[model samples]
Target: MADVATTVAPLVRRLLGGALPVRLEAWDGSHAGPDVPRGAEALIDDAAAETGHLTIVVRSPDALRRMLFAPGELGMARAYVAGDIDIDGDIFALLDLRHRLGAAGDHVRVGPSLTDIGAVVGILRRLGALGRPLPAPEEEQRRRGRRHSRRRDASAVRHHYDVGNDFYDLVLGPALTYSCAYWGDGVDDLETAQRAKHELVCRKLGLAEGMRVLDVGCGWGSFVIHAARHHGVDAVGITLSPEQADGARARVAEAGLEDRVEIRLQDYRDVTDPPFDAVASVGMFEHVGAAEADTYAAAMAALLVPGGRLLNHAISRPDPHADAGIHARSFIGRYVFPDSALHEVGQVVSALQGAGLEVRDLESLREHYARTLRAWVANLQGDWARAQRLVGPGRARTWRLYMAGSAVAFEAHRISVHQVLAVRPHADGTSAFPATREWLARPLVADGTGGAVGG
Candidate 1:
């Protein structure tokens, strides 16, 4: 009976079809998996390692104990968050392992073979991993109250956003825009791509001088200030996080755009002012649960005047059937976005149409989000000490895992994002729209410093 890497290696290899794509280093100073040549050996042993491709480290017996009790993602997530285990290499490799396991099919999930279970249990017993389930990390959150109720929604928002402005500033870059960026041709770097994204949104909404705009779930007033200062629009940005509202207001004041922009700590449902020229909900629609889709669509509709545009930019499930029976209640649901939900792009369009907003455009930015997330992960890892200092180790680990995992997920197309441009047509069934999309791609200064004049 050994708790060494050899014991753990065989089990994982058996589960993943007898060959581990990743190296495993167990708590007992033993290692297993592929024999790498020379320096490539470290290529993937560090989860945050840029050159690393595949390494999973069981730092303690508790890592296995946690997994033994919980199984699947949750247990693994807890082990990672608690520092019981560490990863080296590309997270995508883990996904690949799952793909291999899927070939094992029903045996893996529906009902694992009894012999297989017995083997795992026997190994765990030998490794001293069979025990009471460890407590979940304190960082894990499960929201209370009615789902999407204004109060509960606010809690969920704060849980994700209250992580501090400085920390977000570091991860999100100077743009401070937390959404899928436009990685258009020759557009490199996070800040530039993010500005391109905002500019693209402004154009899609047809923003111009004297127009009134609303930014729902505005993170920190970047969009509203951009709209008002550059596009000359009177903009109102609303958010559920008090910290975010304060940060946005402070930013607006700093920009001397106080007269043109307002940051309200309010939910979209509580907004009373209407007849705006356009509305923008970027990266925030996930919190609007599927059950509240109509309410969300109607609210956006109610906020726009006739002929005004609404750009609902959100991460969406690739298809309604794609996520069927798959649960979001895994690690992300319990930790990062407690009550979030993703709907299919078509379903989103249907909801908007149900509220009388004509769905105009749906462009997938799936790859762009992957790029954005990769940049963010790099930023966090680059300044990891600072990040850990700002948010503590557990939260820092959470963000690193969340952002990197998201980047890979986006690349895999397991999830997607879209910029949905819709319009509130006039009573006569008329709405203003350009005949071509050529104007939307006018190249701007990649750094967001000078140029890229807004209309």
Candidate 2:
């Protein structure tokens, strides 16, 4: 057969129903798509090109089999995660192609059209690349049992967050936050912006001295520590992951705030304490599943006292369709955030309101989340060696691919992260919330040296 790129180009272009936009290079030193520039190597692998220009490097014949067996996105992701494929010239450039693919629908999933299988089989046979299915990388998580049940949810949480505390610390830095950060104009580091984000939530919740607060799905207890130390609130942070709960408790103890902050290895549904003055759910409800969304909102509402505020911070899609949650078969579902689903802001508002909370304010921190993801990508890439050692190369590659792809999606508005502020009003309709949004933008600290947030 002709060289791999020569044989593969036209066929892929036909399956995609368009001309190829990215350069294709193969392990055998064959190339296709865009003309090779004067000085560049015939088979290029560099990752420094302009946006929208990229190279898909087929590193092994098994990459083709992986794609053949899984089809659509999963096949391609497995190839990438298993080191059979690599993207050259900026992962963003490659990810941008995801939306262009007819079946991808603008997310981490890379769904290239898989039609005309006879043609594909014919081509593969001629190229001597056809083979039976290979075992998926060990890192892929095969979800089992009933979805959204406490037992199943616990398993899913462990799949995503039980990798190791050290692994998260390496990626998330000292703030140990796993959500979007409140970025300041002059902020230069991830940890500082993370700290600002936690403090911002504290202010938004109207936290005050001696007030009781609850943090739902509190990853590593950063929010609880920040509120208790800086705002003097008595705080409870709860998470489903044992690893996260352990890490969060250690952090609270290390901060010398054990008396002020408590971290529990508990689910929000299990809490039966008296009403708290405020409640915050940061980046946690995505795992609540669309089917259990109402339950989640009701739980948060039940935890709050009348006139108490609740900050629901989580990722959302712009789609108005109630069923527009992430596909269960997508890359994120299988390998990254197992059983996670993104609800639109409208759905979230409805749930909160249906649970008897008034949505007071809505803010989209879409751009902030994009930047946060990129920072995490940078941290992972910079410490790639250590990361791979911590989580294995397959899992490490999965994180890199997901974060970079998510950055592209956020920049394009395909998905977003929102901070929805709601309050449980008194029977007579007193919200006790500030009439304006000014309170949310206060300086990070009283002295003002730490800089302003949400400004």
Candidate 3:
């Protein structure tokens, strides 16, 4: 029986090779890799040192075996998710190292190279007696049945949104609005910004007193309550998550607007009524898979009366060729938003037009979403202990990593959020929209107090 440290030392040696730019420390009190870059002396903590120093603590030898068996991103992800490996230094730098090692020509491919395969084989051959491969964490989702089907969509939505409303409350502020907020007009507070966002959507859709509005994928009834209480519209909100529907109904009742607001656990496709004067779908379009985008647009178009307005607010991937489904092997699909899909803005516009709706206005809220995510990250970090207790450590870590990464992506313009306003034209070929965008600039205050109306 050999000690674990002795078993892994040779593997680490072969893994780093001779010309090492990084330092690797093992949990067994053994060190490998060059003390410094191939040619330079070790500075206290220079940028190079920052990028090069990585502290890896292996909880179990099985972790290394699993990593070596699979290799590349999926293997690496499994090790982290299973709590077998921990990286103490910069995670992004480690990602960069992986990119550098896997680059081909001018492009960086996420797949492993032949060198990577050879290295894994060598590691396994030397330390094959350690342990057998372990199954991935129970958290990884593998939904069965047809994709985007009504029942399947409900399961997917519940998997993500039904993770305890208390957990969501800690992440989202008092308003509990999960979508990107409107941060314009010097609105610096989260609650205020969220209200401003709902107000902006109402103004864009031209909601008025007695006008009927349908809020698709309405989370917690934030927008529905806001529209009914603030915009004087008779609003109905629908969601696939039963928890959200319950919370939203309670919220509407609490707002004392039960006569004007209705929240249901219903699917967009199941919506049979079509007399709504205006419709708003915020943060919901992403759930409509690319394959279902046409159906979604057509459904919304049919729901609206002639000359009615529709506002589709959703996040979009800037890369034209990015997959609409969750990124390959990403944590978002495994733990966060299972079965979610994101479409490009152009694709969204085309779908709307194909559904017989004429595009009237388009606004990008990319930076606002970045700011909103940063706030959510701060809130989660602030209540880290409670979050872990609510959702367990693995799920909490998933949220932190994904939220921080999404904020960076939004700031870098790798992705964006857009509000696409289109209207069902009258027979006269007029959209009935104001000739100018001036109507949106007016401050329409339906309530004197600026606090959040309902849950």
Candidate 4:
């Protein structure tokens, strides 16, 4: 068998033949270059080079073959997920390298570039006939049946969320809120930012004492617990994940608000309870695919009473026509959020309007989401070893990469998170919302303890 050094040396040569912006280090202690044709020299990752910023570590020759065979982002992601390739520092900066790879598509008009073809041949020759190496079964998501079917959706949610609550606690901080947080000048911590986010949703919905609120896709009862405790409302939180439902019910009981909060392991389509005074769905909207946007809006509207408000907080795509083939098949879909879809904000508004809901207000919290993801990444990195022990390295890699890549995407405006406040208007066509958006400006009050969320 050829040694790791000889196998990676030629592969590194081919990578450098392009204008990659990082320095590559092989298992045998060989270095590539800081002499990138484009991008900052400081972004290069060389341990001995003082100017290096990022370093790509090639752990094995098979890892190199994985990239060479697949090519492009998916190939790179597979290597990362398989633990064959590792990025040592500033994984966010690796986005720059991805952009370069995307732009290099111009070089392959008809087929693979000469350098790419050569690298594949060289890596394969060294690695031998390793026929179609599959990612660790635990790493890849296997969903059956039609896309977005109820059973399949539940499976997808379970695959991602049923990784154990202890694992999520490490990544999501104390609040256990698995969504974008609302960060402000006063919000300095993850728990605090999450509190601000829940409170913001409550305030936007005009949640009040004795009101009935329904929280769709509620994870661990964060919003439902918050709403029932803080706003003195009867809140029902529903999720498809059995693990989440179990955790949420435990949390509701722990908060001693079991009477006011009901955590149901049910799907939104089957939720028969109607005439909720207010409704909130956070981080759940993205899971409702584009084809089902209208169905989702109509369902929520059917459960809401006239004059009741609904706040839909979800991620949105800037370009509706953008090809998300990479997202659908990459680590995100394979491990993180299988079959999830992000629709344009305008499409969301149209769907809501078509469902007889009035669009009251729309606000972009893109920057806040970026900040939230950065905090999650920090939490994950801080408890890196523990997280790996809890969910294993492959799953941990999924969260770290997904979070960092999403943060950079948010920062670049390639994607965004929006809080769309809408209301089921009365027969007289009145929304009953405050005349101005001033109501949302009020300072949110929380004990900062991550204690029983709401009041």
For model 2, give the 10-residue run with minimal summed lDDT: 39-48
TM-score of each: 0.90, 0.92, 0.84, 0.88
Residue-wise C-alpha lDDT for candidate 3, range 1-455, written one tens digit per residue: 34444445444434433223355455556544445333322211233454755655666656666665655545555666677776665544543443334422111123233356665555456655445677877667777789899998999899888888999999998989999987766567888788888888888888888999999999999998888876688999999999999989988999898999988899999998778999999999988886899999999999999999999999987766777777535556666676778888988999999999999999999999989988998898899899989988777766776676677667667678999999999888887789999977665332447432211
Deviation in angstroms for 59 in model 1? Answer: 1.2
Q: Which has the greatest lDDT?
A: 2
Query: Which residue pairs in candidate 3 have backbone atoms (N, alpha carbon, C) closer than 3 angstroms, thus clashing?
Result: none
True lDDT of residue 68, candidate 2: 74
Candidate 4 lDDT trough over 10 residues, lowest sum: 103-112
Give the per-residue lDDT of model 4 (tens digit) for 1-455. 65454455444444444433466676767555464433332233342243247777878656655665655555667778888788888877665444333422101111123457566665567666345665553577757999889999898888888999999999898989999987767668888788888888988998889999999999999888888877889998899999999999999999999889988889999988698999899999988875788999999999999999989998888876664222564556666788878788888899999999999899999999999999999999998999999999988997898888788778877788898999999999987779988877667647656543322
Which sections of candidate 1 miss by over 4 Å? 36-53, 92-98, 101-117, 322-328, 446-455
Order of quality (lDDT): 2, 1, 4, 3
Better of 1 and 2 by TM-score: 2
TM-score, predicted candidate 4 vs. hidden true structure:
0.88
Error of 4 at 108 (Å): 19
Poorly placed runs, candidate 4 (over 4 Å) = 1-20, 34-53, 103-118, 126-137, 323-327, 445-455
> What number of backbone clashes does candidate 1 have, counting pairs of residues 3 or more apart or in separate chains?
15
